[model samples]
Target chain A: MYLFRNYLLVFNILIFFQVSIFANNRDSILVIGKVSNNPQKHYSYLKPMLNYAVSHMKDLGIKKGKVLMARDNNQMIQYLQEGKIDWITESIFSALIYQQTTNAELLVRKWKKHSPNYYTIFISKKGNDINQLTDLKGRKIVLEDPGSSTAFYVPLMEMINAGLTLEFLHSVEKKPSGNNVGYIFANSEINIATWVFKGLVDAGAYNNEDWKKVDHTPVVFRKKLNIFHKSDTLPRSIEVVRNDLPDPIKKRLKSILLNIENDPSARNVLFAYQKTKKFDEINEDINNELNRARIVLNKVHENLNSL
Target chain B: MTMIIQCLKKINKLIFLILIPSLVQANSDLKPLLEVLKENETISSEQFEKIVDAVDNNDKNNLGIPAQINTKKNDEKELLIKIDNGLKISTYDGSANFSVGGRMMIDTAYYSDDKQPIGDGTEFRRARIEFNGKMYEVWSYQLDVEFGGGSADAKEVFLSYDGFTNKRIKIGQNKAPFSLEELTSSKHTTFMENALPNVFAIGRRVGILYESYQENWTFAAGFFGESFDNDVSKEGDESWGLSGRTTFTPVSEDTKVLHFGASLNYFDQEDNSEVRFRSRPESHVTDTRYLDTGKIKDVEKQYSYGLEFAAVLGPFSFQTEYINTHLERKIGGADDLDFFGYYMYGSWFITGESRAYKSKSGKFDRVKPLNEFGAIELALRYSMVDLTNGSVTGGETDQYTFGLNWYIKPNIKIMGNYVRVDNDINADEDGGVIGDDDPNIWQMRFQLDF
Candidate 1:
């Protein structure tokens, strides 16, 4: 009986020590990333930018910037809720989700790859009879990964608004029942193009930027395919900070990033960071759009969960 | 006999009436049996006709047995091969994607008024097949081989690690980081071939390179050994070099850009290194080089520095580069030789399309047409090279060129260039003192990539 009590006391002490360490380390800036399609590939581009941002914040007791890659959206939400991640850069869809679940606030809009905004474009083979969204019934559509806003959610919401029933399939080869449009996840923009071009799917959807990229949709394929529809534009990407972060650090980070372009020494660092053009302050119109996006995200979540 | 015939007819009628219903229910197989019965005189002609009519009616009414349906299982595994844009094959799990592509360029030139005969003929500029892909999403590789100009060559066979932020480490045969023109892909260059300064650009070499970039700038440096497929070195000697380039863009946008860059190259020559610099009259098909720097002997080390500036404002873009090369001799009391060259060019798009600037390499990329018809571009350039310094007179030359390019598609283009060359009075072009001979050349190329 005495030995058991001693063991319990030792365990309690260890737990207390771990809690203290974690509490002290909470002040360190933690950059969180969700593995969208390719974890390693995405992290490779994010790490340098995170390092540069953290290095500029050394005056705020930010000695280092650490990256924590979440396996999925759910895990990312859990991390935000637990206050484990202090900052995040994500797509509009993910930003909406975090805004609803964890109260993350938008800090700035990142001009990723020099593109400030992008819109979804629905494409089909030139001779396929699918000319409009209504004609997609009973046909299969390929989409980029679920995390992509323009490729997945924007088009999906539009389709839902059109009163078309959608059924998710495990692969592109699966057929849908009559009166329902089948959709499959391609996990990449190029794969979506391939699916539509090779007649594996009746239609495909992605951003206009990808459609124009020669590498993604080569000229040979573009000759045989045509865009049938396009969605409204949305902000490309944004940087967000946890709402509970200290206000001083927030202002300082914003100041540092917004003025990074003006500094000649930071040129190479900024160029390496995914060719980031510059960070701009979020405006009221963007805020309203984000709110609307939140509603769309909620509806999408309900539909997917029910399915 | 009449009574017997009447009895047989009656028997046939009764048999036909009984078998007609079965024939109607049976498939096409029963029709053969009915024909046999009629042939053997077991049934009358009218009875046989009635059976055939019933079978045809049943088939139309879907009452016949499903005509020996040939059902196939369709068990063939779908080969995940895709040829929509480019040829690509991928795994179902999205872990691997591979693509095969190639490009070809056919060039022809006609030169006039050359005192020292310049060959005017047609030649294949580049015919290359390239294979590139990413493995496990973090490692990427490219293997390119060229078969043109009556010879086969290897180009850009390298593996790269892109798992770093805005940075990549490449190891293999690749262009040493030195000049913007040399780094930019050949398919995207503004002219058919680079200017005279390209002779000192330190082309592709076997090397290990590191590259990183930010929004408006890029920095690349590498340590390189002798070029791939170079001649075997003598015993106890080998060639090696180091080169680096940095570029900064003050203004970089889709339609506007201002770029500035600098590069440095240093190399140690092997024993008996005979280095020479020469160029033709802005044409690749001509065998005669008007500006020839004869072999410089007793060389130990060579270094080159270059300055570059480029600006793009909508349909108008301008670019200029100045390069200087110096050689340090190994023998004492032998004066070192110095050479310098510069070129400036400007281009305008008749269709109002701007030159596409690739920020990754700080160079120009493919020009995309805004309209359906296509885009047309016009360019003019002035280049000069001086190789006569400190008694090693390799001669000097100046050239002016005008170019026209029609981009019919992203992968297909037709280009035409008219060049005028003037060499110095003491130029020794063909191993002899051939006095200043002016030449006017016209070149054209049909290029395609996939």
Candidate 2:
């Protein structure tokens, strides 16, 4: 009787398992993706970091995924909501919008050059005698892209923090120019670098990556420009996952990923990229910092709205 | 004559009552002509009549004058075609769109004068129809149909509900996701059709599919399956089965996207049922011998296995898959056959643009400037399969393919490929000997959307 009962129980369990497959069609997982926009040409500095991420997905159970090549923030967000993706590595502005709309979590921030920081570098022509950030108050300045994290956000924030009033002496007309001191979306850092070198803009602000590429401080503005100020370091890019993901799977993925370098099985994929060590533990301090950024932006938005 | 005059007077009175005060709304009114107005209303009517009179005279500034020559503006809607499988209908706002797409491939095989010719090289490959779209903010669906020369003709439809729960439940005809090529959209296949190994175990299937995806991973499970083209009535109780597949890209949102995947299928055939093959036939028996399709068969048994791999790079990428299967055959004499096949293909863009994605800050842009002429792409593929591991023979087949593609626009592309097939015969002599005897085939395709 006991044996028969056990067999019956097993049979019953099997049947139940079979029925649930069709009965439950309502489970979900987060989908995430990011693109370097331009790896070979513009964002070459960030390529090593991306390769590290690609070579080591087996440790996280990811087998086949697509890296979308995109050129605009709008396209990136569209992919995210289209079920074509779940996660994204993007600028703070884009991430802010996604987090607010999708309730996606900010998992971890990257540390560039082994430091969790970044800053904007202001540059000018060779010999025009623009020594201070304030001195360019009424002059023209070139901006890389309106959505650029470093070229726009960092500089804008620093300006506000420093109480430097911005009066659009005149908006930079989007014309193809070697150099002109106006807010122009050059579409690339090299273009911006070239513009400053050729005496197009009176001054400009770019991240350290762009600054490092230029051999001469300024050829056109060789005597015109000087570093007026530098902003404080901000957090690097972040890795985020949807909060609704299963805890166990998420935990396993995170554990395997954070310590990928130590796992023999994951070394080759991880080693493809550089400037990445490991995912450190996240805590309240990081959250607090993110909150501070949000607060600052909210204030700006409120001011804009009131006006 | 007097009566006629009196009637005329009454008609004039009625005309006045109807036409005098309502003259302002006359443009909107359609009525019988010839009416009279009361004397008192005639003053108001006179003013109205003056307006009408002015309009009747084609006055330059009358209310009845043509409402500006440009009142009816010609606002035309734009049409965009997405190449994924359908032609999408989008409005000016781009917030809403509906897409309808389809594919049809008729391939005839002509078996060369080999020692044994199974059916020569001649048969219809596939006839397909697909409907897909994003209805609004939170809904999307895809329906597919297949009709062609095969063991069976069938219809497979999947109604997908995406976004509501971040889950997609496909109820209809599709794959169970047991293989890498099995889950990829057929439209994007490197070959005109999937490998023969896929036809045996991971062919297109029909079932209840529940799939969930995260940034780099996808988990899908389903049950109550159907054969590739089997009819619902023929299934009976034996038709029931279970299948599931999981896919993950460990490195997503990076310049190089890497992925891994695994899948399973389990079935319980009816007692005394001769249903050994799933959707595709395992072997073709002839007077000479049997031609294997690379499948393990069992009358009443479970089917399951695992597959894993990675895909990486930008304008260039590569993929690999490993599979294992066991079968329980009804005949006591033969054991289940086991086989494995792996393929790697790489693609590079000679043009400035990159692969299309839904992100703005990515390598490629669909809305490239008009100054750009077009994009050129080159791809190479190599695949090897060992089909005689567990059967009566031991033979391995290898193939190399090279392709060149021209993308004239976002919605148009022309592609041509040359493939070389090499065979290594080690199994029974009946397996056919081709001491590296090779064959080269050429194919070309032109694709357009929208």
Candidate 3:
């Protein structure tokens, strides 16, 4: 009777172990993203690329991959904290937020939309007196959405560092008084250009790529505006993996992404994946820049708390 | 001093009761109001300082109106409407999407004097409205209607399942998998009309098709019956066909592409078995078809095949196609008939724009201008068709055409073409025999698509 009981206990343990192993293999890797309002469109472009990467990692025990999109950064943080998302690709600012909030580790730099990096440009009408960031006191300026790094955070950080007192205005037309630069969020790059060109705002700030694009700034508008200042270049986007992910899977994913350009079979999938040019290891310079951005973000938080 | 202290305490209690709500309501700093109270002698200096500290602490702890928690669930699905270069409407969550777009082609042509009467006039070559959308994330559908050719016609109306990677299955009326020129959208074609080889290409039909594509290649095959609104046979007999096409790109890039493709079609005719092949002189407004196979009678089966080759090098491109069709007669002792045609064309963009290539479909897409004024394209083509096979006397003809196109925008263009036609003595137009009459034609079209 004692021998039979021990045998049954061993058998049950084996079954449980097998079941757990199967469950892990079912969705071994999860690629997560923040859901754009257009989840289906986003999924359509994202699924194939992730599938390509997952297929290449089958030897690494990644049998399958799944994609999950959070509605916002807060939800994304929740998912990351729960270990539901093992890998991620997002803008640098969002990556920083996720890094600070969930301890996600940056894996590599991504050349999203075929651009490796972009810089913010401060613009005003050609005849305007605001040729530099210091002259923007007591005037209205427009920036892109608050979530945008190049258009919002980078430009705002530049102004703050230039010793200009800044106030977020409820509207673009509301002017602030006495050495304070009033700014409003335009929510779109084209809107920023239009607001500055039409004199609705005294100046505007956005990425230099948008400033050079004809669709955002037409030839006529281009002639009317002048880029007086440009911020330091920042990485276009980055890839991250949860710190708790298995070392082998993380290594395999990084290897696959970094070598996708060398694999001709992944060409179409890569092109469809937001027209990504390639992936490369994040250099020390970029890492240092990210650290600097973290400091700026921390300072901003401290200032807000002091208020 | 005791009386003053008592009065100040009473006033401070009243002020706290009144100003606390104001402070919460205003969402402002407490220092300014506290200073004002001290200046007005409403409170002592020590009381003012204490109250200021308490208010600041309360504000820091968010003891205000609970900071609008944004508890409002964002359950209302947002509908996104955008009008940039095109018009598109989609659900914010992307579970469902829809787009309404259309295209118009206005054509005019003038023909030189010919032995047979040929009409020269203006006509609406193609005017179509299309609705495309996705449902359930995996299903997509398109419905297109044409009002050109002076009548309403249904074009592509199909629903597709795109659940698999690099593959899709479609059902309903759609173009049969065939030649490259026949598959490319008319709005993006180099010429206003397709070339002679298109005569043998199976056009649109009601069908079910399966398609799969890789990075540099595509394969499409389908089984099709008569097109929508096709005339019903007397005994409800329907013709059916099986067709397939495959294309491979040995080298494909943004500015360069080399393509090779082939297609095969087998069609089973109805009991009557009557098929006709005809083409105009590279112009839409002209009604006379100098090259006509008239009618092949008692056709049991028809088999057609096409070969396509195309290449794009920077600002220049070359395209050519050859197609042949064989007919089997039902009557005994009747020899089988064969018809063949081919066309070659070359185009150069004066403003330096390469024709966009869609690798998934193995076809050329719209041309986008690099400049504000737009891009210019110059092209020349030579085509020949021979319908003179055993026991068939469908005259032979050759045509040379020169074209000029102005792309004002990605979706709008103006085009002009000059064609010179050469016909053999056996050629006939409008059921009249023409003794080797050659004609020159001039055609123009204004087109728009969104």
Candidate 4:
């Protein structure tokens, strides 16, 4: 009975969130939003593309482009609801929130890093004897930031589904009691890799793509690490426009980005924009993939938070 | 066969229909699936309506609806773009890519002659264009062509595949798994030139290498032969070799790291049976080698091993390596020889920009400046090589070097190194110069990469 009440409460909260009011703060300029703790890097990456997009949108009343950075996912959602940001590129988990909670339109799917999907992996030292997700009990694992889908939510979901009880570690020194897995957020992928490599924690979780990237998971560290667990493929990142954005403007912006790869002049600009190859329309295949992804994402959000 | 497949699909839908009346929830995900089937003509309109009515719809849930589906028309191929990351000439699916980049290092040296006349001049140390890229995501390749030393040569031309789990394989001309100092890319090396002990490192050879690494350690091994441009005129059959290296890091972070590694190289000179060991005085402007073994014949096998250690703490870093080489005379009694060398170095960034270290390759990466002007670093190194053992008094020499570097940009830098060479009595260019000679060398470089 109590479980049912909790479900009811979660459903009510989700419904309340879905009926969000978008602020009509539209102006002559187009605002591109990003969620990042490192504003400088994110700004430079977003600026050129925003300028390119705005340049092509002069006929649609977009005279200039501005980049706004949100420090976290929740803040970015608030910005979108308030119409302070007209367009945003987001990872799957946060993108799901914007899609469900507000009238934002998913403009196109961004092939981030040129791949439409990436998976999360759980890593431990080579000889930890932790071969599977269940072995993480009574030990600690490190994650990236709370805003990360691969580093945080997907792994959290896997643990919950595996029936492992979770206890949040306030510090590395803290330990979980019997039969519980303790976890902490290390703020960056490299930090998570470092903590696991140094044995400050029993394991770490992040995307498989980062596992291959030398800068994130150093080659030295990879020599003695073991990826004991992997999650299902998650949806790639997405681009979305606020619900109230003009239809013509939204369509024009999307058309420009989907065709950006064919433009010779935008070569460096596209390369600098984040190694994006081209945007894709969310076709039937993608729609089905997204359905599965969102279901698990919703459950992860609702189930993990109360714990 | 197509008709059979279509029939199988319809049969699956019939099963789905038979089960849904008992299992379907009004807000269940099956609504989309049903709509898809109907749109694709898997179910007739009459049948769809009948099934839609026969199912007892439960309470409506508003948990999973994208607003665009309810209020906006999304069938149009409108677009949106986002980028935040990676490589070049990349395919849309990230399966293939290509990029070209290279570096130009122009150097000048002033040799303070002591007992020998060493040339003092400027030259291009390394002028090379490199083409590198990935194909099919897991396959990668690099081709580096060097136009230095008044000639053109291929350096580190290789193709690699990383498709396996936590492992990679490379085949072509590349560096053997040997020294931490030798493996680090020249573009990011602290000093303009490697230390005196680098002569013991058998650098870039044609080979195939296998590498596997985990969180705290790495293991690399390879089979190699003579360099690409080896002369077949005197060819009694090229020497073949095997080399392997293993490294472990107890701690690795953004600004803190501790690394220890060991390597072994074995060469079989079954037919050639001759070798020479030589090195410059840690400076390239003068081709005069202060230490040279000339030629040692009747060699059957060559054995070498190296030990390496390095660390980085904030803006300060330390590295040391020791190498030992032993040769087995095929037919001579008591004619075996041994040569050993070692180098220790430390560097600090006074401008507070830490030397970037790549734990992946166990090497120091390029350091970028923090401020607009540039970054400055002061470094010192002490290296010793003793090629004099038993019957082979090739020579022995030691060097003390001081270096200062100014990195004006990530891709451009200026470096100055002052080296003092101390030679023993047998230290001469294969009896071509006076032994016990000492030289003070000052060298500078202007480097840029694109």
Top candidate, metric lDDT:
3
Colliding pairs, model 1: A270-B214, A270-B215, A271-B213, A271-B214, A271-B215, A272-B213, A272-B214
Lowest lDDT 10-residue stretch of candidate 2 chain A: A38-47
- How are the candidates ranked when ordered by lDDT, highest leading? 3, 4, 1, 2
Clash count (model 3, backbone only): 1
Model 1 chain A is weakest, by summed lDDT over 10 consecutive residues, at A32-41
| Runs off by more than 4 Å, candidate 3 | A1-31, A34-41, A49-88, A101-236, A240-271, A275-307, B1-77, B270-272, B433-435
Instruction: Write the residue-wise lDDT of candidate 1 on B160-206 in tens digits.
Output: 99766667999999998877777778898888988888888898899
Which scores greater on lDDT, model 2 or model 3? 3
Ten residues in sequence with the least summed lDDT for candidate 4 chain A: A18-27
Candidate 2 global lDDT:
0.51
The candidate with the higher TM-score, 1 or 4, is 1
**lDDT tens readout by residue for model 3, A1-307:** 9999999999999999999987776456655555464565676767777788778887777766665665556556766777767877788888898899878999999898799988889999988888889989888889886667787778778888898877777776577778888878887887888788889999999887787664566555677899989988888889988888888888888888999999887777776777788999988988887887887667654553553
- TM-score winner between candidates 3 and 4: 3
Candidate 4 lDDT over residue span A21-128, tens digit each: 222224667988777544444654676688789889887767767767665555666777777788888888778778887867888888887788889999999988
RMSD of 3: 8.7
Using DockQ as the measure, the top candidate is 3
Cα-based lDDT for every prediction:
0.78, 0.51, 0.81, 0.80
> Which regions of candidate 2 fall more than 4 Å away from where they truly are?
A1-307, B1-130, B133-140, B145-156, B161-166, B189-196, B232-238, B271-298, B302-306, B314-316, B331-334, B345-378, B389-396, B406-411, B424-437
Q: Quote the positional error of residue B232 for candidate 4 in Å.
A: 2.6
Best by TM-score: 3
Tell me the docking grade of candidate 3: incorrect
